[model samples]
Target: MASKLILLEGVPCTGKTSGARFVASQLRGWHKNVRLFTQESPTNPVDLMNYAFLTPEQYREFPEEDRVLFPVEETENPKGYMIPLTELHESLQKELESYRFYGCQPWEVERPLMLARWRAFAKEAMESDAVWVLDGMFFQNPVCEMMMWFDLPQAEIESFMSELADIIRPLEPLIIYLESDQIERRLREVADQHDYEWLDSLIAFHTGQSAKPNEVPDLEGCVLCLEARQLVEKKLMSKLGLDRVILKNAFTDWVEAYNFIRARVYEKTMGKPSTDK
Candidate 1:
């Protein structure tokens, strides 16, 4: 069967968002039902970026009126009932932000919760004809959590990703990795483009981890960390046992990149080469 899932992954400044959108557009042109889910998209099926996960006990403690105000999704995990943290009013969000899953939970708790979502998504996706263009779900966000937030060992990270690969294997998902040749220069470019505050926050996020002495003290350190991350991501991509392509980050010629990706995605889903000119 043809693949329904297309995953775009890379380190920062690698244009994953654009790649995802382009892939979705190309698939749509082919008359496929495409759903593009960027990394920050709140409606991403396989990831809960701004959602809060609460145990049954914690959820029950919420005021009865509040419980009925917003939507919540029940999960197989006894502890994981999800509510939208961003959708709630500011005051209410403040009260529950601590329960947010991404940065708030430890890896031990987060690993299963995240995998469960992937499993469910894979199963449900098989039932639909809609093609899903997902940016960052396969590697970027998960790697960030495992490496920076939790300081997990490399083996654990690989294991977690391996399990995800297995769950989605039936879909024969196509993985597109944007490869960056100039890590430091690209990071500096990103820093220059964004506000100092954003860069500062990112630096803090990388340095303020379990490791000591602020290893990622500045932009240079950030670049090093990203380089290391790219190595691991490439390693995983090489051995994922799935159909994939590594596209060099095309800063100067996005039209070329878009064409290349579109052709790859088309071949994967159509079970043959694309004849687009």
Candidate 2:
């Protein structure tokens, strides 16, 4: 049983994955149940939308069907999420794939189906008794990816975020934003740590600077795209107006960050001040 939805979001190497694992363990230590969802984890039933975009590894295997367009990660039945795309209404299949990927705007044909999917996710998560820890679903997936793909304006981003906020309000998510003080140092570290040979793909995916994956784009372009994205994310996060904890230098100060979140979750779940505080 999940009591709350805690979404972890930040730039690369900002301890999102590590901190998510840490927080989940902390919750468990408190005699609370928690479920962790991350991209690196096995495919979930609701993973349809996430795999719509190619990961770094999947991009390297490009020209494969459904890489960028209508991407689908193979998954066995009885998935952890327990909600399969096959169960969706037959009419929504085509648009569901596009909407899952944010392929169209909210006012377009995919709007209703897209909103339905968001509602479905939030509803299920809200009803769960365990605290669910998810990386990137609330903020990163739609905000950054859609902005980079469509070159959307701030107004458009704000509106879309508003709709999303309203849909998930029932779950009462506490967003733990993993931020870094030394942005450039962290950027370089993430790039180097992965032994990344897919700079062009990374750049193109994040910024939409290249038309196709084959085109080699310079690092400068990617840096600029990253910088621009940071601003947009900051604005959108503020607009989201959910319960938030911004952990500056989260990479080094994760213990403090985790303690803060532990208190918040305890308060929400127990409906009182946490003994942790």
Candidate 3:
């Protein structure tokens, strides 16, 4: 089978990570080369502090460029090169207080630069021989050769849909939307993990924004919900669709999800066992 690029897009708090993991496990079981990349970096407080320095309205109105980078300064310290001392100090205090809780060094506060780094990473992944399973809120960008949209409730996505559309347009890959109920349940399940509080907040905020009507752009690809997976199969019969893609119920336990994916892999590989074993 030809190499496939699967992008799983969803608001924060939605179960994209779990779903992506399931997909990756299934692909590996089928003996297809697969690599799963999820966004795991912590948000830098310096970046947030700088942005927050502006008046709330001003911050909201600031040009994307201004919001992304600091102004250049002639001093050797450089204007934007280092995180603001005050912000860094405050962040350090928080890190020290929550050192055990945080479990990682605080992220350096920088904007678009980090995003650029991630883009480079994705480019490298695309160049590899393995099937790529990217899970995140990567709005449809030119960098993405193919795309998938996880449809969730408008209440769940809030403003993120608009923000995402502004960066990327008309993705040219299969778009899969988990029904709203499933998406919500997944978020709740993730929130149950005590250590995932930050992730939970991020998801809740985004999902709330996505709920706004007309926020999400019209994407160019197949749209599948939890129930629609069956329909997708019927629609793609005889076509070289995502043979690697599998349908999973939102309510199903993780084990069932694993089995569902494994079954699809078995079908695709004609019962060939995964070589990884």
Candidate 4:
């Protein structure tokens, strides 16, 4: 079979991580060569992982001249040079954070750089001979963040995603959408975690709430923005025409969601139900 990439995605607080992990576990249980790639997972497609981790301050601090590097290991692979990952991450952390630098404006630089990195990752993964179960896809990163960066219409965003789908089509993508009917309650559910500062920051940033008035966004505005973002995501992703398995409010209904996805994936892989789907 062709290499596969299963992407888990959903609104904030919708248990994307838990679901992705469980699905990957189930796939593995079935004796498949499935690899799970979450944001925190150390072993991931290097470019994608690095892009996800890039910070706003790091991006702003990155200098212009540090774009690409020339690695002279053999002294004559004239076409061979490295994009300095360490140097880039030192200033700008990941592709998502680049949105803070001015959204699509930074696309000119970020687009080529990240595209090259993703190609490297795709090539490497294809050769590694493992199916990828990614906790987040490009749609979640630069794409969702881009929605916030620009005043793009849903159609345009969909167009962008379609283009990306084509670029990574070699992996035979499968998107798993974990959705929720309880956005407000889910936010509170996530708030209950209350331990990690990163979680706090993520909540604040996603909700559009600034600590001080005029220092950040207003609460209501942020909530609406997030809703709009999720809505567009759901709509456009379906338009991508990739195989998809969607579960409603998977955050609260994990086991049901897990079983549903497990069965679907089995059927997809083997061309038959695992045990009466």
Clash tally for model 4: 7
Candidate that would win on TM-score: 1
Model 3's lDDT to the true fold?
A: 0.38
TM-scores, all candidates, are 0.90, 0.71, 0.39, 0.74
Tens-digit lDDT track of model 3 for 1-277: 4334555544434456666677777778667787676554233211221212222343345456544543321212112332232334454434323221111212222224334434444455446666666665343221111111234334323233333332222222233323233543444465466444443333333232223222222110111222243233233322323223434454356566555545544444344444432
For model 1 the TM-score comes to 0.90
lDDT of 1 by residue, 1-277 (tens): 9999999988878899888888888888889998899976767787777888888888889999988875788877656588877678888888888898888877777888888889899988998989888998888778888987888888888899999999999988999988888876776677677755666666666656333222345766777778888899998877779888888867657889888888888899989998989
Which stretches of model 2 miss by more than 4 angstroms? 1-3, 45-113, 198-201, 209-217
Candidate 1 residue runs with Cα over 4 Å from true position: 209-216
Candidate 2 local lDDT, residue 171: 74
Q: Rate the local accuracy (lDDT) of all candidates.
A: 0.82, 0.62, 0.38, 0.60
lDDT per residue (tens digit) for residues 1-277 in model 4:
5436778887777777877788788778777788787866754563332323223344345455543331111211222222323334444335334333223234444454455556766777677766778876656665655576555566666766777777677777777887777775565556566544434455455543443332224434555666777787777776887778778877566667777888777776556767944
Predicted candidate 1, C-alpha RMSD = 3.0
